[model samples]
Target: MKRASVAVIPAAGFGTRFLPATKAVPKELLPILHRPAIEFIFDDIVGAQIPESVLITSENKSALAMHFSEAPNLESHLQSNGSEHLLEQHQNLLSNTTIKYAIQDRQLGLGHAVLQAEQLVGDRPFAVLLPDDILLGGSSFLTKMLAVSAQLKGSVLALKRVPPDMISRYGVVSASQIAANQYRIHGIVEKPSIHDAPSDLAVIGRYILPPTIFHILRSTPSGALGEIQLTDGIAKLIESEPVFGLIVEGDHYDVGTPQGMLACALTLGLEHAEMREHLLEIFRKWSQK
Candidate 1:
C-alpha cells in the first residue's frame, strides 16, 4: 500500500461570496480564531503525516505562499523582543514541510485547479482538501481515507449525509453499504435537483485520489457553471475503477459565506477554554437585550 505523499489544496477561487473583505485578503487567509482557516487544513495534513502540500493559488493570493514561507525579519523581531510564545508558535512554520505552489491563473473550475498539480504528484496517490470546508473533531477523516485507499488501492471520498433539501448544495453520491460507515460509490451527481438526486450522501471536501483522475479531468466537459467540476471527473473515473465513500464524523461547517464564517467563529470561540466563560457572558447579555 503506497502512502499518500502529497496533499493538493485548491485555494484559487475568487471567493466572491466574501467580497470586500476578501477584496484585499484571500479567503483562505481568513482567521477562524487566531490562526488562518487554511492552517486547520495544514494541521490535518501534518497530522496525517503527509510530507508535501501543494497549494493551488493564483497571483492575487501570493500571500498564501508567503504565509507558509520563512520570514527572517519577523523571526528576528520576535527573538529580540523575547516573544518566545509567539516565536514558538511559528517554530513549525509551514510545519517544516515542503510547501509547493501551483498557479491557477483562471477560474475554470475545481478540476482545472487540481490539474495544476499533476506534474508534482506524478504517479502517486494524493489527497485533495477544500479550504472552505472546515472540520472540527478529534480524529482525522483524512487519515482514515488514506488507510482505506491504501487497503483497497482505490480512490476514497469523505461523505456526510445532508438533509434532502440541502442535497442539491453538494455533489451527492449513490452508494451501497460495504461495511460499517463505509460504502461503495456507484454514481456521483453534481448539484443535482432533489427530484433527480441519487442519494443524500453529500460529498465533502476530502478525497484520496489515484493519479488516474488527472487524465479523466482533462477530457471532462464543463457543466452548467461553465467550470470543470471535479465531480464530473470522479464520476467518469468510477466508470472504469472503484471509488469508495466513508461517512466522516466531524462538526462540519462551510465558511465560504459570511454567515457561515460568523457561525464558525462563534462556535470555535465558545469552545475555547479561555473564551468560553467570556463568550457565555456576552451571549447572556445579548439574550437579555
Candidate 2:
C-alpha cells in the first residue's frame, strides 16, 4: 500500500450558500474566530506532518493564492512594530508545508475540482480535505484515516453517525462492521431520501483516496445537480477495490452554512482561554427556563 504523501484540498466552489460574504471572499477564507476556516484545514494537514498540499481552486480566487504566499513588505512592517507573531504563525506553516495550487477554471463540482489536482498529485495516494468541514481536534483525523487506508490497502471515508433526519444532506453508506469503529463499505448512495438511506453513517469531508480515483472521476458523469459527484465516483470505486469507512472520535462540523459556522465559532470560542468565561456567561443568560 502506498502511503499518502500529499493532501488535496478542493476550495473552488462559488459557496453560493454563504452568498454576498463569499462574493468578496472565498468561503474557505472566512474567519473562524480569528483564523480563516482554511487555516484550520492546513493546521490539521501540517500537524500530521504532511509535506505537501495541492489546493484545487479557481483562478478567480486569487486571494486563496495570496493568503498562502509570503508578503515580504508585511513581514518587514510587523518586525519593526514588534507584532511579528502575527506573521510568525503563518511563516511557520509556510516553512513546514509546501502548498501548490491547481486551477479549476469553472465551478463544476467537488469531483471536477478534485480532478484538477491530477497533474500535481500524479499517481500517488492523497488525502482530500474540505475546508468547509471543520474537523476540530486537529490532524488526528487524517492520521487515523491514513492508518486505516494503509491497513485496508484502499480508500477510506470518514464516517459519523449523524441524525437520521439529516441523512439526506450527506452521502450515506451501506457497510458491514469489520472491526471496532471500522466498516467495510459495500455500497454508498448520494443524498438519498430518508426512506432510501441504507444507514445513518454519513460520509464526512475527510477522505483518503487512491490515484485511480482520478480516472473514475473523469468518467463518473454528472448527477442530478448537472455536476460530477465525488460520492458517485467513490461508489463506483467500491466495485473493483476495497473501500472502508472509519469513525474516528472527534468534533466534526460542516461550517459551510451560517448556523453551522456560528455554532462552530461559539463552541470554539468557549474553549479559548480568553473567551471561555465571557462566552459561558452569555450562554447562561441566553438559556431559557
Candidate 3:
C-alpha cells in the first residue's frame, strides 16, 4: 500500500484552555511527563514511517519548530535531576525525518490552519494529527488508517464510540456499518446537543484527507466563531466524496485541558512500579487529611 507522504500537524491555535501556563509557551510545546506533548504525535508519525511532517504554526510559536531540532548548549540541570527521561523540554531531539514549517499568518480556525499547507502538501493525500490526541503504547492506528484510505480511495477519520454524555463534546457522525469496527460516514455534526446527536461514533483527532478537501475547505462556511472550522469542511466534503471512519480501540487521550493532561501523565507514570508506589503513598497521605 502507498503511504501518505506528508503528515500535517495543526499547531496554530491559541491553547486558551491551558491559559497562564500557556501564556508564554505554545500549548503544543507544553510538557507532559517531561516531554513536549507534540512529540508524542511525532512518535506516531515516525512509527508509521512517514518521512515528512509539516507543522502549521504562528510566528510567535517558533519554539514548536525548534523542539524537533538540536538543542546545543542546553543545561543538564535545567530540570530537576532524575527526571530528564520524563521531563525533557530541550533534549533528545527527533532524527531521520524532514521537519518542515508552514506559517499561518492569522489565527483562524482549524480548517484555515490546515489550508496553510496546500503549497507544501501539493496534490497528494496527507495525514493530519492533532497534537492533543496522545496515543499510548505506540499504536498502529495511523498505519491502518492510511491502508484503509488507500484501499477505499477516500478520506478516513479516527472514530471511537463515546458515552452518551460525552458525545456532545465531539463531532458525532451518523454512519452505516460497512464492516467490523468500520463505518461509511453519512454526515457529521459538530459539538451537537446531546438529544440532537446522531450517533455516539465520535471523530477524534486523526484524519487521512485527500487533496480535494482543500477545495472544499475554501468554499466551506465559517461556523461557531468567525473561524472556518475543519469539522464544517469535513461535513461539506462528505457530500461530494466518500468519507469513512475507523473505530479506534487504542489508548487515546485528549490532553487539551489541564485535567486531561494530568490524567494522561498519571496513567503513563502509574504503569511503572516506582511511580505507582510513589503515587499510592501520596494518595494514602491525602486521604488521611
The best candidate by TM-score is 1
How many angstroms is residue 119 displaced in model 3 relative to the true structure, after the best TM-score fit? Answer: 0.5
* lDDT of every predicted structure (CA atoms): 0.88, 0.89, 0.84
Can you write out model 3's per-residue Cα lDDT over 1-289, one digit (the tens) per residue?
Answer: 2358889999987899998878879998887766679888887787778888899999888877666666444435534354455434234325535889999988778889999999999888899999988878746689889888888878999998889889877989999999988899999998898899998889989999988889988998776576888888999889988999998866879999888899888997888777889888899999999
After aligning candidate 2 to the native by TM-score, how far in Å is the CA of 136 from where it should be? 1.3
Candidate 1 TM-score versus the reference: 0.96
Q: Please give the ranking of all candidate structures by lDDT, highest first, separated by commas.
A: 2, 1, 3
TM-score of 2: 0.95
Q: lDDT by residue for model 1 over 151-235, one digit each (tens)? A: 7778999999999889888999999999998999999998899999998899999999989899999899987778998999999
Minimum summed lDDT over a 10-residue window in model 1 is located at: 87-96
Error of 3 at 130 (Å): 0.7
Clashing pairs in 3: 33-86, 34-86, 34-87, 34-88
lDDT by residue (tens digit), candidate 2, 1-289: 5889999999888889999898989988898888888888888788777899999988778999999987989989989999999877777888988999899887778888899999999999999998878887645688888888888888999999988789989999999999999999999998889999999999998899989999999999897767888998999999999999999577887888998899899989988999999988887888953
TM-score of each: 0.96, 0.95, 0.90
